[model samples]
Target: MNQPVSAVAGIGPRNEEVLATMGIYTVGDLLTYFPFRYENHEIQPLSEAEHQQRVTVQGTIHSMPELKFFKGKKSRLTIRILADGLLVKVVFFNQPYMKKQLILNDTVIISGTFDRHRLQITGAIVKPVEKIERGGLEPVYSIKGDLKQHQFRRFVEQVTDGFIHDIEEVLPESLMSRYQLMERKQAVYYLHFPKDEQAFNQARRRMAYEELLLFQLKMQWFRKNERQAGDGQSKSWDAEAVNAFIKRLPFELTTAQEQVLSDILSDLSSIERMNRLLQGDVGSGKTVVAAIAFYANFLAGFQGALMVPTEILAEQHAASLRELFAELKVNIAHLSGSSKVKEKREVLEMLASGEVDLIIGTHALIQEGVNFSNLGLVITDEQHRFGVAQRRTLKQKGLRPDVLFMTATPIPRTLAISAFGDMDVSTIDQLPAGRKPIKTHWGKRNMLQRVLAFVDKEIEKGHQVYVITPLIEESEALEVQNAIELHRTLTEALPHRRCGLMHGRLQHQEKEQAMADFQSNAIQLLVSTTVVEVGVNVPNATVMVIYDADRFGLAQLHQLRGRVGRGADQSHCILLADPKTEVGKERMSIMTETTDGFELSQRDLEMRGPGEFFGVRQSGMPKFKVADLLEDYRILETARNDAAKIIQSGALFEHDSYRSLLMMLESDIAFQEEKVD
Candidate 1:
C-alpha cells in the first residue's frame, strides 16, 4: 500500500518535502489535517465599499495590474478591478510573483478582511471559469512549516476525494438515526467543501458528536470496569473518630464542608474502590474535607497520602495537618524534594514501619523507595497537577486505596463530564464563614498612582497587598510590569513599606522565605508572578493589583482574585491594562462584571476559543485533541450514552475488529497508572 505522495493532488516533490517537515507523510495524514478555520469565498460586491476602507469585492480584472519595484528594496503591484461599475484598488506588498498568477480578464474570487484604506487580498484565489463553478465557503487548514495553503488545500481535497469513497460509517445505524447525524462520508465532504452555512453547521455537529462520543465511551467503560471489579477494599472506620477530629478544629465546619465530608466518608467506607472528585472554589475549605478523609482512614489504622503540586504547598499542608493532628496526638510527616537525605530516609522508615499515620508531599511522594504501610486513602490537591498515572500509582500502593481528588478551579458541567466521568463528583460551592467577595475594578496604566495609593491605604491599615505581574523576571515586549524590577522600585519609592518578591525563578527556599515574611506582616507588600495563583492563603491581604490585566484570561483573573477576599476585611482586585485593542477592553469588561469563577470560565472559553492564554492553555484543564472539553459538551453527553450501550452490549470484548483499540487503551491506562505512581 505504498502510495505516491503526489497522489494527494497538489503535492509535488518540493511541496511534499514541506509537508513532511511538518510531520505529514501519508494521504491519511493529509486528509485528517482538519481546517483550523474557513475562508468564506462567498464574494462580496466592492461597490458597497466606503472610502478609506478595505473590502472584499467579486469582479473581473478590468486590466492587467501594473508591477513596479521601489528602489530595489520592495516591489508594489496595483490594479483596477470593476465590481458592478465600481472601481476597487487592489494592492499587493512585495508580491510581484502574484502578477503572473492574476490572469487578465479572469473572474477571480478575492477574499480578505478590510481596514479603512485599501482592498487587502492576502488570500485571493483565482478560479478559471472554464474549470468549475463557484460560490461556496473555502476550507482553510492549518499548514505546517513551509507548506502553502493553496498547495495544502489542493492535496487535502485529493486525499479526501479518495478517502471519502472508502469511509464506512463507524456509528451504528440505530445511533445515527437517534442523533440525526449525517453519514460519515457526506459529513467529511461537506466539512471540506460546504455548499452553505447549514451544510457546514450540520457537518461540524456530526464530527463534534463523533469525537465526543468516543471520549464518553472510553470514560464510561473505565467507570463500569472499575465498578464491576469491586469489593477489594474492606476496611471501615467509626464515624465518631472522624467527628472527634473535626470537633478539634479552631473554626467550625461549614454546612457544605460537612455535607462533602459525609460523602467522602461514605465513599471511603464502601468496599468498592473510591474514585471521587471534590470540586471546590478557592478557600472553600476543601483542605478540611480532605483532612477529615485522611483522619478517617487513620482511625481505621491505615496510612494516607496527600499529594500537592509544589514543595511549598506540600510543606504548608503537612504543617497545617501536623498542627491539627497534634490535638489528637496523631503522627504526621512530609517528604518533598527539599527534605534532607537523613530526614527523607527517616520518613521512609517510619512509613514502612507503620509509625507515621499520614504522609504529605509533592512528586517526591511518587518517587521510588517510598513505601506506605497499609495505605488506605490517596488525596490529590488541584487534581490537574497530577496525571491519571500518579493517582493510579498511589491507589495501587495499598490494594487500591480510595482516591479523593480536589480542584479549586471550578469546571463547567460539560467539561467535568468529559474530563472526569470515570469518577463521582462532589461540589462545594459555598464559601466558608466570614469570607467576603473581592471588589473588582478595571483601570488603565494612567491610573497606576491611584492603585498604588490604594495599596498604601491597605498597608496603612496593617493589611498586606499583592501586586501581580504577567512576567516573573523580565521580558523585552511587556514592559508595564516585571516583578523583579517592581520589587526594587517599590522598595525605593515607598521607603516606609517593606516589600518582598516571589516568582517561579526563585529557589524553593527563597520563595518560602518571601511568602513566610509576607504572612508574618514583615513585608507590607509582595510583588510576584502567578506562582501564588493556588493554595496561598493570606487573610490579611486586602488589595490585589494585576498589571497588564489584559494579558490574563477572565478565569485566571478570577483565580487571582480568589487569592484575596478570604478574611472579614473588604478586599479589592484592581485590573490595570492599557486598552489598545478590542480584546483588551473585552477582558477588562469580563473582570468588572463577574465574580463567579464558573461564569468567568465560560466567558473565557467564549472570548479566547481554545489556545494558550497567560501560559495556561485556554482550557487550563487538560489536553485533548479532536475533543474540546467545553464547546463539544453536547457531543460528550451523547458519547457517554453510546459508551454505556457498547459496554452493555458486550460485543467489543469478543470482537477482534476492536481488539487493537482495546489493547491500546488498556496499555495507556496501565502506563498512566505507572507514571502517576
Candidate 2:
C-alpha cells in the first residue's frame, strides 16, 4: 500500500500524473479511490430495453457504420443494429475506430443511454462478444484528467490484485465483531471487485462506519482533553452594567439572541476558557452579541481581537464594532495584510501599547509583529472560513482567551455536534425584524434568455442583479458554468448596462473594486462564484441568477440566496439548472419550495452529504474518504456514542486495544492536524 502508484503495473510517469489529478498518488490512494457509481453490463434484448435508461443491448450489425464529420462539428460514427427482430440506431462521437470493430453481421454489445430521439443509443461502449473479458457490475470511479472509466477500473484492479493484504486491520476485533463488519482486507477487496450487489453494500458499510468512527473518536478525544486543561480566565461581571449596555443598542435583541448572550456571558465568567460557536442565519443580530462579549472582556481590563476571513469583512466588522462600543469610549483599530505600511505599523504599535481597547483584522492580526498587551477575547467572523491551524495560532496571542466563533452558514444540529465537537455551540435561530423572504424559482438553462430579459427589466427599475457561475473559468476536465464567460455573455446581451466580474482567481484589489462598484450601483450586473457566498451585502441587488445551480449543495445554494433579500424590496433567487439526475432535480425543487436555511441544511446533509454539503470548493473542513454524514447517519450516531464513552473512560488512544486506530487517525490528513492542549 505504501508503493507509489507508478510502481503498479501499466502505470508510467504520465499515467501517474493522470491518476495524481484524481487524488491517487500512492498505491494506497488507488486502493481507497472508491467508485461513485456502477453500471451493470448484463445485456438485454432491444425489445426489453427501457427508453432513456442506461441499458446494454446486444444485436447483429444491421447496416454499415458510416464515418461522417460536419464542417464545424465533431466526427461521428453512426450505425444500425438488429436486436430481437427490432432495429436500433447507435452513434459514437469522434470514435471512427468503432467502425472497424463493428462490421456487417457482426454481433456487438453496446452499453449507454438509450436515446429515444431516433430510437438510438448515443456515446456507447462497444464490445464484441469474443472481446468481452470482464462482465457484470463495472465500477465508474470519480475520475479526472484523461483517464477513462475502464482504464481507472483496470488500475484499481491491478493495485488491488497483489497488494490488498497490505491494508492492515485498524479496528479492534471486538468492535468489528460487535458491528458484524468485514475485515479491512476483505472489505477493500470486495469494494473494488464486488461479488454481487449485497456484498458490495456490506463492504461499503464497513468502510463508511470505520471512517466515521475513527473521526468521531479523534474529535471526541480532543473535546474532553481541551475542556479539562482549556485556557480561559475567570471573570467577575457587573450584571447591571451589562444590561445597561444592551439597553443602549440601536435595536432590541431577539429572544434567541438574548438567550445566546446569556449563555456566552456565563461562559465568560466560568473558570474554563470559552470556545463556542454562534450560529445564525444571515441578517441575524450576531454582531451585537459579539460586541457585548467584547465589552465584558474590556470592562475586565482585557483587550479584544476579532479576526475575519476577508479584508473587506474585517473593515466592515471594525466599523460596526467601533459604533457599538462608541458610548463606552473603547478604542478600536483595524489591521489587515492589505493595509498600507503606515496604517499597519500604527495599528501594531497601538496594539502593543494597549492603547487599542479592541482590534479587528484579518490574518494580519496573527502575524509575528502584531502583539497584544493582554489579548483576553478572540472572536472569528465566519469561523469555518479560517483553517484550524490558523485559528489555533490566534489562541497563542492570549492565555486561553474567551473564544467566540460567528458563522452565517446554518448547519443542522447533528453536523454541528460532530464537526465542532471540540467547542460548545449557541444558535440564534431567529432573524431580525423586517427580513423579507426571498422568492425562489427554478428553470433549465434553456430559459437563459428569459432570465437575461428579467435582469434587463430589473436593471431598468434601477435594481442590480447578481449572476453566479460555479467555476471561475473553463476547465477541460469539468463542464460547469464559468464566471468569466458568463460575464462576457451578459455584457454583450445587455449592451448598455455596466457589467462586472468577480471570482477567487482575481487579485484582492480587483475583487474589492468589483464589489465596491456593484455596491455603489455603478455595475448593473456582477457575475461571480461562491466567493460572494458570504460577506458581501448589497441590499440594492434584488435578483440573483445562479447558473448550474444543480451543481451546488443545498446549504451553499441557500447561502447564495441569502445574498439577495437583504433589502426590504421584493427579492428573487432564480436557479437555472437542467439537472439530468433525480437528486439534482430534487435539490432544485426544494430550493423553490422554501427559503428556510436550516431546513435546507438538514435536507442538504441528507441529500448531498457532509463533505459535499460543506462543498468541494470550501476550505478548512474535514474530509472523509468513506463516511457520509447523510447516508450513514445511523452508523455515525452509533460511532459518536461509542466515541463519547471511549473518551469519558479516557482509554481511546492510550489503551493498547486502540493503538492502531489512533495511529491511523494521526496519519490521516483528512482530519486536520490536532494540536494537543
Candidate 3:
C-alpha cells in the first residue's frame, strides 16, 4: 500500500506501461492481481508421472516428426520425444504444421495430456525451451493483448520475491487466527507464486475473505449515510391516505405488493434516512408499490420525484400515475427531453414554487435549472442504468428525501444481499391473481412463416404483438435481425395488418409516436429492439416473438417475455433461435422451461457466473479483484458475519488492523463523494 509499482525490481519501462494498463500502478495492486486459474505440472521423471494426467515434460525429439492423413487432411500427426531417458510419444490432431516447426533431436518443452500406460502425450502445447515457465504448479493470469503469459508470470514472481513485505495487514489478528486464514503478506506470496497446492488453496481463501469484508464494510456504511443530511426526520405515513389510494385502484393489490408497501412506509417513517431497493419480476407491480411510496411521501407534506432511464418510460410513468392518482387530486408534473418549451417552463415554475406535488421524468429532471421546493421521495426505475452522480444530483434538490430504486431484473438472492446490502431490499415475488403464466416455445428461424401466421392470428383476436430483434439495422458484422429490414419484411408478409418500427436510434418524437400507435391499436404489430423491454406497457399485446433469442441472457429474455401476459388473456412467448454453441442452446432451453423469474435468475448465475451476471463493473457495485460472488459465496457469508461482529464491537475505526481497513476503503469513499460533488 505504501510503495509504487516502480519500486518492484526488474520492472523496466515497457513492462511498467503494460502493467499500468491492467490497473497495476502500485505494489498493492500488482500484489493483488491474483492468478485466475492454476496448472499442476511437477517436474518429475516421465516414468514416475501418473497416467491420464497433464504433465509438462521437457525433452529432445528422438525421431523425425511425421505428418500423414489416411482420412484426407483431417488425420493426426505423431511425433516421438525423449524425456528423462524415456520415449514420450506425442500426437497432434490435424495440425500438420507441427512437423515443420520441430525436427529430430530438437530440445523442447511440451505440456500435454499423458497416457502413462503407453508413455504418450496428446493435445500438448509445444513451446521452445526458453519460453516455458518451468515449475511444479504454474499460475495462469488473465491475459491482455501483447502480454505473454509466461513473461507476466515471471514479472509477478520477481516482484513478490522482492517486495511482498510491503503488503500491510488489514484484518485483525483475532479474526485472522480465529478463521485460520493465511497471514496478509503470506497470502500475496502464495497467491502469485504458490509454494504448493496447500499454500495455493490457503491464499485463495484468505484473499476471497478480504474482498467480501471490504464490500460488507462499504455497504454497511452506505446503509446509514449515502445521502446523509442534517435533517433525518420525515413525517409518518398516513394510513388513511394509503388505504384510500389502494381502494381507488380497480384491481386489488397482490400480497407481495402490500408487504413491500409496508416495508417502504417503515423506511419513510424512520428517524434515519431511507435507502431501499424494490426488486420484482416483470409485471410484478413494483410501480404501484413505488407509486404509493410517492403518494405517502406527498401526504407527509413533501414533493416526490421519479427518474426513469428512457424518455418513453418517463412518459408512460407520467400517464399511468395521472390516472392512478386522479382521485388523490395531487398536482403531477412531467419533464423529459422532448417536453415543449412552454410546458417545460411551466413545470419548472410549479416545481420551484411548491405547486407540484409529484413529478415524473427522465435524467432531465436532475438538471440544475429544475429546482424542487420540497422533494421528499426519489424513486429511480432501472437502478443500474443511472450512475451515482445523477442520483446524488437529484438528492441535492431536497432535504435528504427517501431514496427508492426499483429493478424488474430479479437478482439472485445471494447477489441481492451482497451487492445491494446497503439498501434494504423488498421483493414483490408474487404476481396478481388470474394473471396467466405465459406459454413459451422455441423454434428455428427457418420457421419464420409459421411465426408470421401466428402474429396475424393474435391480431385477429383484438391483441397486438411485439417482434424484438437485437440491432437497429442489418450490420455488416453481425448476422442477427435488425429493426429496419425486419420491419420491412413483416409489413410485406402481414400486408393486412399495420406494422410499426422502434429503436433507440430513432428520433425521440418518432419513438414516442410509434409507441403511442402500438398502444392505441393503430399498429397491430410492433417490430422493435430491446428498447421496449422495460416500461412500454401495452396490456393488449399478448404475443412476443424474440428473434435470435440465443443472443440474449436469461434475465433479459425474461424481461422481453414480460412485455406480454399483462392482460387477462393468455399470452405466448416464442423464441426463434439458431444457437451457435452449447451455451447458447442451454440459455434458450432455460427460457422455454419456466416463467419464474427468480428461478431463471439463479440458473443464469450458474450459466454466466458472477462476472457476466449483472455485469461486474456496470451494476454500480464495487468491483471484486479476487472473490466471485457465485463461486465464493461461502467465503462471503463468513466475511459478512465477521463484519457484523466488528460493527457491533464498534472497533471499525480503532486499532491498527481497522486503521488499514479504513485506509483501504478511502478510494470507495472518495468515489461516492465525487458523485455528490
* Candidate number of the best lDDT: 3
| Number of clashing pairs per prediction, in order | 6, 1, 0
Tens digits of per-residue lDDT, candidate 3, 1-677, equal 64777777767777778888888888777778888888765555677678887788889988887777866669688889989888878999878778888878889888888898888999977877765443466789986758898787777877777777767788878888988999889988787767788888898889889989888876666654654554555567679878888888888999889899988888888766788888999999888888888888888888999999898888899999998887777999999988999999999999999999999999998887999898888899988777777877887788777788899988887887687776778899999888999999999999999998888888998999999999998899989988899999999998999999999888998998999999999999999999998877999999999999999999999999999999999999999999999999998888989999999999998998765777755566556777888888888887877776776566886666788787777766542552211
Per-model TM values vs. the true structure:
0.88, 0.76, 0.91
Candidate 1 versus the native: TM-score? 0.88
From the highest TM-score down, the ranking of the candidates is 3, 1, 2
User: Which regions in candidate 1 have their CA more than 4 angstroms from the true location?
Assistant: 1-17, 20-23, 42-60, 68-76, 81-94, 101-125, 131-135, 610-630, 649-651, 654-677
- Give the C-alpha lDDT of model 2: 0.83
What shift in Å separates residue 204 of candidate 1 from its native position after superposition? 2.2
In model 1, the worst 10-residue window by lDDT is 668-677
Give the winner by TM-score: 2 or 3.
Answer: 3
User: What C-alpha lDDT, on a 0 to 100 scale, does residue 128 get in candidate 2?
Assistant: 80
lDDT of 1 by residue, 1-677 (tens): 13656676557788888778766777655655577677665655665655544344567787788989888769878776666675656667787888987877777655544433554443344555442332356677767677677667767776776776766566656667888988877887787778889987888788777766655656776776666556447567787776777777889988888888888888877777788889887788999888888878888888999888887788778877877777675798999999999999999999999998899988788877988778888898887766666666666667678888898877767666756777789988888787788889988878887788888888988899999998877777766688888888778878899899999989888999999998889988999999888888888998999988888777677888888898899999999888788988988987888787777766776676544422342223334434565666667776777777777787557666555445545654432332211
The alpha-carbon root-mean-square deviation between model 1 and the true structure, to one decimal in Å, is 3.9
* Candidate 2 structure, TM-score to reference: 0.76
The per-residue C-alpha lDDT of model 3 at residue 67 equals 76
